[model samples]
Target: MISTAWGISFRAFDIGQLRIFFAFGVLQILNLIFISVFTLYQMLSVHTSLTLLALTPIFFMLLTTKIIMPRMAAFTRQNQEAVGLLTNRVTEAFTNIHVIQTNASERSFQRLIAQENDKVYATDMKVLMLRTLFFPLMSALTGLSQLVVLFYGGSLVVQNKISVGDILAFNIYLSYLAFPLTSIGIILSVYQRSKTALERLDPFFNETPESGSDAKILPFPNPNEVDIQDLHFTYPGSIHPVFMGLNLRIRKGEMLGVCGSVGSGKSTLFQILTRIYEPPVGTTYFEGKDVTTLDPITLRREIAYALQKVHLFSASIADNLSFGLIDRPSEEELARASRSAQILKEIESFPDKWDTQIGEKGLRLSGGQKQRLALARLFLRKPKILLLDDVLSAVDNITEARLIQEFRGIGCTMIINSHRGSVLE
Candidate 1:
């Protein structure tokens, strides 16, 4: 049941105020620049007394960073990706709890999480090892520089070339070098993580938004009519084509059935028709207007596309049925739609009736009940066009029969797909 749409949750959380969090890193970088300059200038003046020896720590930090940053960044990125996969495993496991319990695959799922957790642990250990070592290594270099100063400067004082006061002042300056030098590792660590977080958020920023939200609003004079021309599509990363130069025209108020085997792009076709996955520009048209030029919000409102999988939010049955409409549907409207989907009888059987709670994705209901509930939601919309992808597959033959009988009363354009030819009939 996973989809490309899962990435949208990552997008929603990463936008808005989170964009400004990176600014703190910018200020930190500026501070780093100021200190590095002042510290180097004083140290260079001292380096004149003993050339190359006083410059040892500066060279050490640069050389160590060259060895460490790339490895640190690589480990950090792997850790991030591991965490995401672990999260996905957890989500999918929870969502598919019913199937897992039914098949007694609880241990299998437990093992799955254990395997993913180990991957995350392995990557985390690599990052921790680098972080733990980096600061100490920098501190050692700074101490080495101090030893160089004491040994060389003490001798100069004995020769009466430099005063004791001069040696003491130089040691005070070296103390300034110690704090900033240690902080560099920490500052660089934060900077590297910030950079990685930004890279992870690119999918959210790069998502293709509704292309025509600002375009001229086109009136759907005949909402039931649709024309698709030269439709060609290929999913990301697959070499084989799904569709190439396809064409179709369906009349207003026509009821049609589509028949195809598995992986035939049947579901994908409905997805494109609803503009869930946008079709290429000029390929899909509704009432003679290109779908790409019409606002997706308005287009989806007219075309009610139901996926094979049914998902219901945790809410009362009445609320789930009336989810998308501008105004709350009336009692009579709710009963009628529920009755049409052959679910009103079941709803009336409950003590709470319409007020009964359905848990996440309607886990409180049976598979057939959840499917009928989804169909009821679609019926409540009275959409101009209906795209059903095996929605009736879950219900028993008797319930399916009742729903099919009620379908004639809808009096709107519909496209249905089912493996069972009897449902199509």
Candidate 2:
């Protein structure tokens, strides 16, 4: 019964702003009928009193349906928001559980959960208080209306204007009407709360994502080069500039090394290259074609990036390496790429070899092993332009030297971003 009531209440409220207009029309119609019927009943003969009594309960039920549901909806929506907030808190804490434990913040987490719980509890109590007050007040109002009907009708019966049987029937109808009239307040409350919930969810329904522009068309030119001219950028909500008039270029088959201090716009430059962040008042051209005009997906596919923080999915080594390759690569091709990355030997040592599962973010592997695995994946991509962002940082000097030598041999247009220049040399 509660579910059915909730569904009806929600439907009435969520049908849009038309709810108010429709509700107003309904209330006006009910008011007119209610006034007209009572006035006519007072003037009608005693024989007609029974007919009026029969409709009284039906009129009260209509009042309950139209009036009470909307108010109940408002309270329900408030409770839902409180629950949503509590759930968000729990999810955020769980996601950052490691950091919380590391900092010994169990008490702080508990306090936050407690605070959210208390807020929900208080809101629930307020809703309960409103419900308690609404029911009794409605019941009293309904009883008073019945009392008026009985007194007036009884007097008419005593004066030989109405029959006793007619008066009794009228009283019975009035008694039946009382329950429905009292329920009207509850119905209105339900409608109101549901309306509030739909309003709260409106933003998500109307949301437009950041990328809504049409893609530009530009063909690639000869000499397959990437150029950044007078580029400038700053992150959203940040006051300081991440990049200021930065200019760089990478020609086909040219290996360019990028060296800078920590937080010196290296990663920001890569982000712009990937078109994750739009460059301010400047252009990045790839193979003589404006990168902004080119599709971001195509640009990213052509330009491979291997970051210091390597991320590997929980899948077999072979699956991770061949991620972007269309039509699964031959076993020989996969082996060749793995060998170049110097991780094939390590994989072979594992019990499952290429089929071994690398746990989330490659947690099962050592830092150097993870870096090698990421490089292996990058090698499999065979991109035209490779962006190696501190890929050798985790490996030892010997391994870094060999990897750099191996990378130089690949002959792709490479931009190596790292503080250590010796690896590049």
Candidate 3:
């Protein structure tokens, strides 16, 4: 499976195209020497002085490598960054279009997009302009080299050392050399742009995996029980600690209700328990075994966590309900789970029923419908520990009470985090 950073890099750039361009540039460079030697040999055969004309192409390559290529690469990098930023802004605008409309901030968002678009345009123009000037500069140097070859070779003919026909032959070979030289310069320009894309992707390839490949898969005797001793933690980039000397325990088949205010680490607690963020070793344990030593994939198998903010893809009701399931649930199984979550009646009310399409993030559904839909998805999977993080927040008292009844009936060790104190009672 790919990580978050890798996913973002893929969206930001076309990696496959970059590799193709880089390979073409390398192959051209490899063939350049043989082409240069074969063409220049004819000139060297006529007179040794005529071979000095090679300096023109050589000087042009040197200028391209030292000055022109670096500038091209720098601007190419800037252009990529600008384009990526603009893409992010566009995605955000579309995702929150409703919010923008309600706030009457359409012009504000438009201005933001216009500013990013200008940057992308400015950086792209710089790269294109540099490439436009590159070919003409090569031609100018080639023309200058021709003038030198004609004057010196003509001198040889006047002294009767070489025939006039030989001077004509030397100039013809000189013209042949220009094509390969100009081709190599073009290759270098394309190569610089590809090289910049590779640099942007380097960090993703170099990052370390959060879980080790060789981590042990220890079986938990009491997988549903949690025992923490003096747990202390602070989020990254935060000075204040969320938990200090926090000790807690939950027995098997027990339902613990956690009530807290906003930013009080209720969600963070669920994250830590599920190994989303690894807890300190010797502090958190399952069946007396240090959780840090367990494989994250193996450990997460016994836990099913439904987040507060439900995420529904643009898919059918059936697909969203059976998400994360190892095997597709049968029609009967889907109905049972939906019934338990109290969403079956609404789903059945639709003309298409199970096949009905739910728009992105379930935009077609109300807040309570979305929450129950998430619960249905959760009910499809049977884990040893069930973590419901403020799942009943959107529903009314009657709906919440029914869901709580459903939770109690499931008979699993459950930890429910919510702001309502009555949920615990």
Candidate 4:
């Protein structure tokens, strides 16, 4: 989704502009041929042999298309790939600058970027050399064709086969062909570059989006129970399994607390429940129906997953709280949600209150504040199942207790994972 929105979006606009330029190029070529054909007919009427002389440049054009064009296209593809890799490296570096600074690994990152930059530079030079060679090669071939025409047509004039006026007129017509012929090479180069870009973007455009069953799944008799049976899951491209024959069931309206040490699949369980990473069909169930058969859009509507690593947008507190709601939530509704999540007082303490602007990923807030903000957003949605993945870990004991009481009163089926036993109790 990020690649579709950011990387391919700008290139889509460039493709549109290329389409416009290519259309104009076609029109110019058609106009050149129309005028050239009339001029050729007049010269042919003067001397039948002169037709052969006018076509001498065709040999040069054929040479360029057959030999030079394929190589140019190959180099263009390499250049584009190199540039894309460099851009990704630069973006990753900036995104993790804080990590690099704290670890004192700036030099290592610089070396990595320099390696990618070197590759980009090499490919760019190859493309530049080809572009530089094209125009001059066309000019030399055109000049050579002109010389051939001058010599042959002058000889025809001396032999009284064609007059001096006829040779001059033929020479004038040939110059008109020069610009169009040279432009054809330039047009083809641009087309090849555009074609390569489209090829790279093809997978993203053709990728099957997250889809649900086209036919409606049968309604569950009990719509509140969450169950897992004989579950076995291994992440793609990894041999190690996260779950093997795991079985569990959470009854309706039950507040099930999950506790485990780090790297013991506590987080992975929540991910499977929320369908962030899909488990095998028939293994995971929600609303008493096979989850894989359910519409992810509708399924997710009733399931809210507040991640351990809270992600907050760089926006006002009210906007963050009201993030997923379809309707514009009233100020009163926002306050109520915040209060339920134990975050209302801190927000109200700010001079701007609900309108306070949180920096990127809530950089202006503490870890506890970010987690509470995410919970507040989830509470506003009023989902059927709440998957809180260590959301209270960062808060103080008093706050955690208050939030725990708040969760109990909500009366929803809750799957709470935590490192602290107090949260599970």
Highest lDDT model number: 3
Lowest lDDT 10-residue stretch of candidate 4:
1-10
Choose the strongest candidate by TM-score.
Answer: 3
Q: How many angstroms is residue 413 displaced in model 4 relative to the true structure, after the best TM-score fit?
A: 0.7
Question: Tens digit of lDDT per residue, candidate 4, span 1-425?
Answer: 44422374336443653575578756766776787788677767776666666676767677777787788879877877777777778878877889999999999999999998999799889878887888778777777767877898888889988888887887787787777767766776777776776776676678765663354555433347889999999888889998899999998889998887778788899888767788888898875688877766667777888888898899999888888778979999998989998889899999999889998889899988898889898878887888899888889999999999988888889899998899999
- Assess the local accuracy of residue 267 in candidate 3 as a C-alpha lDDT between 0 and 100: 94
Against the true structure, candidate 1 reaches a TM-score of 0.81
RMSD of 1: 4.2
Better of 3 and 4 by TM-score: 3
Clashes of each: 0, 26, 0, 0
lDDT of each: 0.80, 0.71, 0.82, 0.80
Clash pairs for candidate 4: none
Error of 2 at 303 (Å): 1.3
Candidate 2 off by > 4 Å: 1-89, 123-212, 220-223
| Ten-residue stretch with the least lDDT total in model 3 | 1-10
* Position 367, candidate 1: lDDT: 91
Predictions ranked by lDDT, top down? 3, 1, 4, 2
Better of 2 and 4 by lDDT: 4
